[model samples]
Target: MSTLEIKDLHVSIDTDQGNVPILRGVTLTINTGETHAIMGPNGSGKSTLAATIAGHPRYRVDGGSILLDGEDVLSMSVDERARAGLFLAMQYPVEVPGVTMTNFLRTAKTALDGEAPSLRHWTRDVKKAMGDLRIDADFAQRNVNEGFSGGEKKRVEILQLELFHPRFAILDETDSGLDVDALKIVSEGVNREHAKGGMGTLLITHYTRILRYIKPDFVHVFIAGRIAEQGGPELADRLEEEGYDRFTAVEA
Candidate 1:
């Protein structure tokens, strides 16, 4: 069964310009153990779709439904959505000055589990996740994302992904601002998670390079505020060859 489903979703945000619509009747579904990729040009509503799924306050869902594991997601609060097994990896991770990584992770772990992990077990799990991501053990003591490089911040997000082990994840531009080495590392972490059962992913990206490392079962092209095209991996190839010109024209 599909773990995540977005049906005829309509999203808009209040801007000085007006009620700017970002997603217009967007619909998609991702089953467990599958990876779906959403590709689009700038202002095509890809990121807006991701943020809406994550319960961002600014991106209001004017219509349609989001379901996770057959439950209504639109009714859930942001933290409730997280606890209900949905994760979003942001393009721009915020830095916290005083909150250490360890503390932040522990809080998240506790919140998701509804109980605290024993000290010994918690330490072991945290160590294992960090090791898998090649993050140093000492990094847990640093403030969350503070003074971290772009690659490092992305790794931290992946670390959270591993820790949360959500049923589904929406990675919004996770490959952006990464060097070759960092991209490989991030893709490797996502691969590792997918190798485990009961996890689906929706990877929102503009470039096809990241798709080379993380092959998607489905590829969707978004233009304006709706899907312009969709298919298998071959769809990604077509986009690479033709660019977004055709889709943009359709949008127009």
Candidate 2:
């Protein structure tokens, strides 16, 4: 099985005040067939960790290493990282004005696989995935994420996850703006991908609602950019009842 390892990861961003730290020596490891949930309050650096892993330009890794199966992920460019099988489903997905979803998916798959997928199989798979996610068939012909609602964008993100079949996926608060039905649909999409036993999921969120559908094998509490506590599914239950108040108090 493939493994994604993060060791003593310290990340920061340049600002008017100079570099400000966001992730303070955060470290975690995820293996294929496992699901990890990162739970925390606002400004706790959950999304920062996700962005750092996906090689986002805004966040700089000042120290530490992100290794994918012993390969140095920190050294790889964003596209290189993606080609190496890391996928990030952003919390706020941006719109691509000119790219059609159909073209984008096929092009990305070709890049990732180093060859074009068979057109017939690709079309069938995309249609099935979209249907499973309850996405309108017309969406394939539309520009990427253009005019889609929050839930629609999130579903599209998962659609990519299903089609791309990355070794690991970092979902940054995927359930944030989804209603109950949309949440279940999106969660089911993730579950379907995870069930394949080839993809590891790093699900970052603040609530336990999504946990009901996408159960994490490990639950980590992110407080001030560091994992303060980690446990099995039981930890999520505790967070649901107690919330991050206790963790914040401890951090304070």
Candidate 3:
């Protein structure tokens, strides 16, 4: 199985105030078929970690290395990371004004795979995935995320995850802005794709509700740009009961 390893990663971003450090010597490893959850309060740098892994331009690597199967991921370009099987589902998806969803997905799949998928198979697979995600068939004809609701955009992100079949998926608070029903649907979509046993998942969220549907093999508590605690699924249960009060208290 392939592995994505982050080693003592330090990251910072430029703000009006100047370069501000967001991640401080953070490290983790995930293998295909493993599900890891990152839980923390706002400003704890969960999304920063996700963006860094996806090679976002806003975040600069100050120190440390990210490796995907021993390849220097930090050295690769953003699209190179995706081609290398790294995927990120943003906290807020942006709209592409002119690109239709069908064209966009096919183009991306072609880029990732270095060839076009068979028309017959691609059509069938896209239809099946959209149906499974409960997305309206007409969404295929719409521009990417254009005028869609928050929940719709999030589901579309999972649609890409399902279609692209990345080795590692970094979901940055996908649970946000989703109601109970949408939450279950989106979580089930993630779980369905993950069940194939070929994709490692890094699910970042603040609540335990999504954990109820998408169980994580490991749960990490992020505090002040570092991992303050780590444990198995049971740790999620405890976090649900006690919240991050104790951890933040310790940090304080």
Candidate 4:
């Protein structure tokens, strides 16, 4: 089974003022077939943790370690991390102006698998996955995220999650801006992948609505870049009702 461990991770971002600390001693472990939800208010260093795991340059690893199956993930480059089976579905997936969805997905899959999938089967697989996500058939021809609605863009992110089938998926606020129907659809797509097993998940979000659908095995309440509390599904229910006042007040 695969395992991704974050051990006392400390991360910082460069700012006009100076290097600003973001993730301070944040640690968590996600093993194959497990789902861990990290929920907190905005600016609690949630996305910074995700971006750091995915090796975004702006976020510098100031201290601590991230290990994948006992190998050092902190040393891997962004693409290398992907090849190592770590995937991050960003909250804002960028537009690739010249890249059609088909080409982008195909290219990414090829790079990850180290072999180009056969055209016939690849086409069929893409179509089926798209259909599963309720994506329009014509999106294959459209430029990636170009002229797409916010919900559509988020659905495409889930499309990548389904198609890539990574060993671990770090979804950063995937439910943001999605309507109830879109949220359910995206959550179901994630659930489909989770059901396949050997897929670890770290779902980060401000609200607990997605948890109602995705159902995390553990719920961690993050405050000021630290895990202030942890519990089972009931924790999520509590957060939905009580909000983050307790956590944020503690941070204050």
Candidate 4 lDDT: 0.92
TM-score of 1: 0.97
> Looking at model 2, how many pairs of residues clash?
0
Candidate number with the higher lDDT (1 or 2): 2
**Cα TM-score per model:** 0.97, 0.99, 0.98, 0.98
lDDT of each candidate versus the true structure = 0.92, 0.96, 0.96, 0.92
lDDT of 4 at 233: 84
lDDT of 2 by residue, 109-195 (tens): 999999999999999999999999999999999999999999999999999999999999999999999999999999999999999
Angstrom error at residue 15, model 2: 0.8
Scored against the true structure, residue 203 in model 2 reaches a CA lDDT of 98
Kindly list the per-residue Cα lDDT of model 4 for residues 1-252, writing each as its tens digit.
999999999988889999898888987888989999999888888999999999988888889999999999988888999999998988998999999998999999999999999999999999999999899999999999999999999999989988899999999999999999999999999999999997999999888889889999999988888888999889999999999998777777
lDDT score for candidate 1 against the true structure: 0.92
The lDDT of model 2 is 0.96
lDDT of 3 by residue, 84-160 (tens): 99999999999999999999999999999999999999999999999999999999999999999999999999999
Off by over 4 Å in 3: none
Model 2 TM: 0.99
After superposition, the stretches of candidate 4 with alpha carbons farther than 4 Å from their true spots are none
